[model samples]
Target: MADLVTPAERRRLYTLLSPAYLWLMVAVFLPLSAMLFFSFLTDMPQDAPDWGVTLGNYAEFLSNPTYGTLMAKSLKLAVTVTLFCILIGYPCALVLAKSIKGRAREALFLMVILPFWSNSLVRIFSWAIVLRGNGVLERAINWVLPFDVRLNLMFTTDAVVIGLVHSYLPYVILTSYLALQAVDDDLIDAARSMGASKLTILRRILLPLSLPGLLAGAVLVFVPVVGSFMEPRILGGRMGTYYGTVIEDQFVAVYNWPLGAALSFILLAVVIVILAAASPVLKRAQT
Candidate 1:
């Protein structure tokens, strides 16, 4: 094969790409590099004159079971939120893409994304109001049902899950909607003409084609949820302590920047490993 670009074109390409590469270095890589350096230190250089480089922070992770337990809890929460998002978001996306059209589709999509317009704290607080004992949810249930009941869900794992799902559900819906919309309607029509069942078409055709987008949404949801502390703190109360909360405490309350950096890097490494393991499956879906 002939070379796709001459030297001049190659130079122009690099020239155009240089600004983005530079920005990525400054914005992302530079901070990460600094953190990696910090993670190996005994203490912040400014905090202590006796500070020295050591592997104790990383070693602590291996020696203590608490960190592992919290990490496992975070991963479990991430998985639960991702599954709920897929279950709820995909069907909404499908309906928006295939069932509705024009103004109605626009209105529904606007609703789906409305949460993004509001501050996340506001959203969490709103859920808090509804979930607290004798709150709106409890009142509504009591009003409709014949019996009195306490529906306080505040400060629970379930509340944290609900808040997270509400916050991240749109990622799945938007990605899946785009993927579903790209499918040729003619193919579905042809399947219908051939008397293929809707289940068969969905299972063998639509789902397979949309797997890449679904997985993308799942990844978007999973990565952040694993490190989430705010939603859990507000919603889970004392129950909301996860790996992320500990990391937050280390940085903010404890002022243990070195240990916090180590924990954050450990999280980043685990996330990378998970994505790497899933890459083959994502590639297969694309094919």
Candidate 2:
């Protein structure tokens, strides 16, 4: 492909892409480079006269078990939220893609993405209001059921999961819907003509074909949710103290930029490793 492209065409293409590349360099790489540099420092150069490069920040991570515990908690929360999003969002995507049609589908798609319309803080606080003791959810449940139920979900891990899932579910649905939509309806009809059950078709055909999109959505949800502090903080309260919150505290409350940079770099490395490990599966799905 490189050989086939003429020099002028290649130059034109690069020219067209230069702005985006420049933006990435400035917006993403510059900060990351600064953070990587800071990660090895004993103190910010601006703050301390004797500041020097040191491995102590990273060493602390190895020495301290609390970071590991919090990291595990965040990873668990991410996996739980991703799984819930898949289980809920995939079915919704399937229905929108294969069952519904016309304006109804458009309306339903709008509803699926409705969460994005609101500010994230507003959404989290709204959930906080609903999940609190004797809040809307508890009241609704009590009203529907004959027995009295005292349901207080706020400040729990479950509340964090719920908020995260609600926030990220649209990613899964949109990706899955696009994938599902691309499947030729004729293929499904042919399978039906051959006496294939809906379950069989979904398992052997749709699921395999849409695996990439599902994985894309999972990655989208997992990456952000793992690093999430806001939703967890607002919803989980005391229970929300995960690795991300620790990182936030290091940068904000503790004002330990070096340590924070080290922690952030470590997280970036972990996420890179995870994505690298999953690349083969994604490639297989693509094939």
Candidate 3:
């Protein structure tokens, strides 16, 4: 790879990559290092005159079960959303990749991925409008049914789940579609020639081959969803409190920067562990 590039080409590559690396070092790494340092302190140095390093924040988390429960709730939410995304998105991907063709397939695929082009905050809020009491969803239901029915989904766990699923569904679909699309139609036809049913082909061929991409998409959705705060707050309302919201409050509402930093660092560590666990499968997919 190195031998293929001229000195000028190498210089151009270095020039393009250097700024990104430098930006990561300054913007992300430096702040993260500072946050980690702050997490061990008794108080933020800016506010407290006699600040000192301490393990009190971590100790607080252990001593109080509330934080642990909230973290558990967050993990549960992540798992639920990931499962739903896989169930719903994978089939959509299969249809787009295998069932559809030409311009229509392209159009549908574009529609599937179009959500990513818009702001996520806007999307979540739109769900809130649709799900709230007597909102668009209820009205639509009422219009069709003989009796008036109220589907007050806002400020509920279900709403949170819906919002999250809608937001991250594209991730699973995009990855799964790419993986399934790579599968040759000839292989599937050959399976049919052997008198294999559709379900059998999907189970034996499509699934095994696409498992890595599915797992990759799950990881993509789960990690960020675990750390999500805004969607829960907007869609779940009073019932929206989760680990992410707690970390957010520690910084913004409570102004306990140390505790916030500690929580944030722990979340980052958990995310790293998750990615590390999934790395082997992702590498296998590439091969």
Candidate 4:
């Protein structure tokens, strides 16, 4: 197909991109380009009509401890949530893959995914209700227990982590389950016949064999977890001073377009760096 396109066809294709491409460039890429341009501007307030070109935004971000701390916290939260998702999701996927089959498996998968079918806002609100001091789930737990106690599960870093893990767990399970399903049962049978214990088979065979799915799931979980705002806003309370909130405030409330753009681009840089660092590990796992 690439070889078949003549000069005229190429010109026609470029001509066809005139309408939709213009909109895309205007609505999406142009703003992004402007953001990148303004990120280097200086000698002007964020809303100034004529902003001069400089690297002040980049320097300020680098020199300011507050932004630095926020970046670190966001990264740490993302890592922790990703790890939790992997730990919980791996076992769940393994069980589903090994035992369930046909409609039962499909049903179980649906159950895992059902939470995601509704609006994410609803999910966050549902968690808020459950995690509140006297929420239904807490009340139910109290009823089961012999003593009365208030569980502080809401408005903390932990709650945000839980929400993120819950939100992305399905992706991990689906990816890992697919990988587990593709594993050869004969390999396990052979290992067993050769006097390998169940634990050894799992640690040595299963984990290694399931690496690709695990990597895929990890990427799916981490990328979005780092950028999540609603989960933190509803669940994080005072401690939820996440960078996403900062970005939101800058763009929406303060209307500091240049600074917000700078912050957003900085975030993109951070994500790119992390992905680049992890890419080798992911690729090796696939191999």
Candidate 5:
């Protein structure tokens, strides 16, 4: 097939792909190269008279325990959020794909996906409104119960988790739903005919079959959550000083561009390693 294309066909193919390839080079490759170049420098060279390339930026991360601790915290948060999303979203997807039919399913799916249409920042801020003390949640709880309630989740880890989950839950549902749609009903019916319990069928058949999609969604959720800054800042307040926030601070507040660039590269390396680790499992699940 590679050799079958004439010169004109190859030219047309390259012509069709050129714009996207060029855009990728400009948008992604160039910025990464610039960041890598800056990461070795002792300081940002724009105004400084004595700027030179050094390994101190990388050394900062290696020598200091604080950054490592914060990075571990970020990883923990990402894992927690990804698990919660999987637990919550996969069920919604199963119900949507296996149980519902026609227009109702379509409507519910649209409702599920409606959040993706809205601004994420706006959504996170709205959660702040709901999670804060004396907000609608407190009022509603107070209304439901006889006791007086004053809820204040503001500036808490729980609040941050909630915000992050709300932002990313739809991704898992979408991916899992797509995977479930490909599952044949006959397989399930056959399992039923063999007197298999519901749990057994789900564990043995559905889970293994859908693992690839679920893992894909989880990776999507995990990668961004690890690098998240906004939700923590708004919802976590004083308690929100995670690795990403520190990276932001290094660049924006501290003006330690070299350190920031080094941290960013380190983060990139972490993500790449994670994806490399996960790829084999995902491929196996697909098979």
Candidate 6:
């Protein structure tokens, strides 16, 4: 009976999976192929057909010192935000993971995630409002603190960093908490019984064990933050422009679709290199 149904069952399973396979090819593969193809093409004006397949776009991006500087600035901001997220979020996650019970923990987690549900544009605007010179925090600070110290929070790189950290903090918290939750309570008790200092236990046991999750969270937050256009657009104001803006201007303002695509793939390449570098570090940490 089993033998008779096995082949039929396998055929049925394959039939069910066929749609998903087709979807993956259509949705993922096709777009990636198009992007790869366009990335090699030269920019064309609206009146012109095309500038033909060439390395000019890539060459321009790489050769220009200004573009390189923008890339470096974006990377620096991302690193700063990622570090801030780790430092602030890890402790919050630990507290949530260790002591908070079921419903309350769920509520707190929901609260943490709630901001992310809002549109990214909306979130940025909200922050912009708050960080404005006469905004709530600024007004409160002025009212409470000493004379004439008006904080110029908006339109600076610091504002962009703060926005990135705020937006992605939940990812770090969730990952770190999940990692912390996986550690055995019995082992922790054993370490305490052996008179291990709290700091020593955390440094030797907890940090090493949680490295995977920390790395995972870092990658999650850092990658998206580095390429993010909206936060920089709103919070960056005049002074703190990132690489995304340059790519955006090429495509939208300059009508250089080919060059925009090329810039995007360049960004993709850089991100891939970063991930490739991290892969070995992640593997080593996990082991």
TM-score of each model, in listed order: 0.97, 0.97, 0.90, 0.87, 0.95, 0.90
**Residue 114 error, candidate 6, Å:** 1.1
- Candidate 6, 125-209: lDDT as tens digits: 8999989889877988888988766788999888898888999999999899999899887877888999999888789888888
- Backbone clashes (count) for model 5: 0
The superposed Cα distance between candidate 3 and the true structure at residue 222, in angstroms, equals: 0.2
lDDT of 5 by residue, 8-116 (tens): 8888889999999999999999999999999999877886879998999999999999999989999999999999999999999999999999999989988998889
In the predicted model 5, the residue pairs found to clash are: none
Best of the two (1, 6) by TM-score: 1
Checking candidate 6 for backbone clashes, the offending pairs are none
How well does candidate 3 score on lDDT at residue 284?
Answer: 80
User: For model 4, where is the 10-residue window of minimal lDDT?
Assistant: 38-47
lDDT of predicted model 2: 0.94
| Residue range 1-287, candidate 3, lDDT tens digits | 55846888888888989999999999999998999998999998889899999999888888989988998899999999999999999999999999988999989978888889889898988998899999999999999999979788999999999999988999999989988988999999999999999999999999988887888798899999998999999998999999999999998999999999888878888789878887886788665
Q: Each model's C-alpha lDDT?
A: 0.94, 0.94, 0.91, 0.87, 0.91, 0.85
Indicate the TM-score of model 5: 0.95
Task: Name the weakest run of 10 consecutive residues (lDDT summed) in model 6.
Answer: 42-51
Deviation (Å) of 188 in candidate 6: 1.4
Q: State the TM-score for model 4.
A: 0.87
The residue-by-residue lDDT of candidate 2 on 46-118, one tens digit each, is 9999999899999999999999899989999999999999999999999999999999999999999899999
Better of 5 and 6 by TM-score: 5
The whole-model C-alpha lDDT of candidate 5 against the native structure comes to: 0.91
Off by over 4 Å in 2: none
